[model samples]
Target: MEERQKIKVGISIGDLNGIGCEVVLKTFEDSRMLDFCTPIIFASNKTISYQKSELGLEINYNGIQEASKALEGKINVVNVWREIPAINFGEATKEGGDYAIKSLKAAVTALKNGEVDVLVTAPINKNNIQAEDFKFPGHTDYLAQELEGESLMFMVTDELKVGLLTDHIAVKDVAQAITPELIKSKVATIEKSLKIDFGISKPKIALLGINPHSGDNGIIGQEDDAILKPVIKEISESGTLVYGPYSADSFFGSDGFKKFDAILAAYHDQGLIPFKTLSFGKGVNYTAGLNKVRTSPDHGTAYEIAGKGKADHSSFKEAVFTAIEIFRNREEFTELTANPLKKSRLKREFR
Candidate 1:
C-alpha cells in the first residue's frame, strides 16, 4: 500500500458567536479527518475550550506556537485572541467580529507563507464584520484582494456546481456590473480552475441569463444577448466548451444543469437560490483562481443554532475532504509541470 501523504490544512474560526466552533469541533472529532491531513485551527484557546465545554464535545486540541510544530493525528491550534467575553448564541457583537477577522488574517498569512496546503474557513457574519478595517462584502472579495487573483465564488455539491459572476451586490447594480470583460474573465477563471483544482481536463460550463426567459430574444432585456452572447462565442471559439444564457427559471428543472460540469450565474441570487435549495446542508463554497486553494461550508454562521449541538458538520467534513483532494491534485500537477517530458506528452495528447 502506498503511504498517505498528509496535507496540512489551516482552519479559520469564523464568528465565535456562531456555529463555527461547533462544526469545527464536530468535524475534527472523527478519526477519519486524521487519515488525509493534519488540521491546524487559527483561533483563541479559550474560545475553543468554551465551545467544547458548551457543546459537550470531547475533542482534544494541541496548542502550538507556530504551524511548523503541528503534530500528526492531532488538531494543532494557533491561538490568536484571548479573554473574549461570553457570547450570546444568536447575537453579533463587535468583539466577535473583530476576533473572526483576526483569525482569518492569521490563516491567510500562513497560507501565503506555504505553511499550509489548503485553507478551510468557517462562517463569518458579514454585517458584523463590515467595519472600517473590514470593508469587503464577504470572504470571496477579501480573498480576491489579498491573493491578487481573478476570483469566482463557486458552490459545489455531488450533483451540481454553480459559479457567480457578481456576488454581494445589489439587484439594481447587477446589470451594470455584467460587462463583457468581467464575464469573459470569470468564465476563463472557472475553466482553468476546473482543470487544475477539480482535475477535469475539459470542463463543460453553462451560463445563465440575466433576464427572464433569456430576455425572450431581447424583448424583455438585451444584456444577455449583447454582453453574454459575445463572451460565450469568444470562449467557445477558443476551444473551451461553454453553453448558454439559459433562462434562470427553467435551467435547473430541465435537467439542463446535469449536462454541464458547472453553471455560471449572472448574479448571486440567480446561482445561490437553486444551489442552496438542492444542496442546503451539503454544499461547499470554493474560491477559485487564487494562488492557494480555499474552501468553506456553503452556509453562513448560524447564530441561532450556535452551541446548541444542533449544527450539522457534514459541510465542514466535506470541505476538509475537498481541500485534501485539491491539494493532492495540485501537487501532482505541479510535479507534471516541472517535468518537460510529461508536460510535452500531455500537450500532445490534448492537441
Candidate 2:
C-alpha cells in the first residue's frame, strides 16, 4: 500500500465532568497513532494536566498555541483557554458545559479554516451544553448549520451502516416529516456518502417503515404505504436502486440488514436503538454530506464512570480511525471522478 500524507486530527474535549478527557487521552496513549496523523487536542494544557493527574496517567504530548504549529509524531494540545475551570466528576455543571463549548468551537473553527483534515469529537452533555449560541439538538444539526450543508447522521461500522430519516424529533411529528421529497433527499445524501466516504461504487440502501409492520400494508397506518413505499419505488427506477419499507422489527432479528450497504430508518430511536445494541463499543457516528469530515463515538459522556479510570476508549479510537479513512476515501474518489479519460486509460492499460 502507498503511504498517505499524515492528516491532522482536531479533537474536541467534551464535558469536563464526564469521561471525555479520559477516553481522548487513553486513545492516543499508545504513541503508535501518531504515525498516521498528527493529533491536535482542542483543550487547555492546564485542563489536560489536571485530568492526567486525576487519572494517574503518564502520556507524552506537546502543547502548542496554534494548530499550524502542530508537530508530526506528537500529541499537540491547543490551549483554547488559559485558566482551568473547576472540575466536578460524575456531574453536570454550567462551568463544565461552557468549557466544553469553548473547546468545540475552537476545533470547529480550525476545521473550517483548513487547519485540520478531520474532526473527532468526544461526548458532551446535551442538556448542559445547551445555551444561546448553541441551540441545536446535537453536533449533527449544529455542524450542518455551520457548514451550510445538509448532514446525515450515519452510524457506521464494519458490519452495517444505518442512517435516520427524521432525527431528534418527536414520534408523532416523525410521520409528517417523512414526505416523498424528504425521503429522496436523505437517500441521495446517504448514497453519495456511501460512495465517497465508504468507497462503495454502487450502494444498496434499505428503508425501514415508519409504522408497525410497515403499516401492515396500510391496515395499521397509511403513511408507510402512501409516502415511503412510493418514494422508494420512484428512487429505485431513477438509476440509484434502493429497497424496503421493511418491517423494522424482523429486519435486524433475521440479519436482513447485512444484505444492504446502508439502512435508513424512519426515526431516531427506531435506528439508533438497534444500532447501539449491535455495534455499541465499535460504532462511529459520521456526519456525512458535509464539506468537512466529523466523527464521534456512539456512546455518550458516561457520567457515572467519569474519573473512575474505567471508561472504555474503543469507540473513541474507532471514531478517529474512521475519520482518517473517510477523509482518504473522499480524496481518492474525487481524484478518480475528476477525469474520465484518465480513469478509462488506466483501466485499459491494466486490462
Could you give candidate 1's per-residue lDDT for residues 131-224 as a string of tens digits? 7878988888999988968899989876888999999999999999999889889999998888888778899999999999888889999998
Please, what is the TM-score per model? 0.94, 0.95
Clashing pairs in 1: none
Native RMSD of candidate 2 (Å): 4.1
Q: What global local distance difference test value does model 1 have?
A: 0.86
lDDT of each: 0.86, 0.90
Q: Pick the candidate with the highest lDDT.
A: 2
Q: Pick the candidate with the highest TM-score.
A: 2
Candidate 1, 37: how far from true, in Å? 0.9
What is the per-residue lDDT of model 2 for residues 231-343, given as tens digits with 9 covering 90 to 100?
88899999987998899999999999989999999999999999999999999999998999999999998998999999999999989889988887777777888854533
Model 2 scores worst on lDDT over the 10 consecutive residues at 342-351
Candidate 2: list runs displaced more than 4 Å.
Answer: 1-3, 339-351
Candidate 2 versus the native: TM-score?
0.95
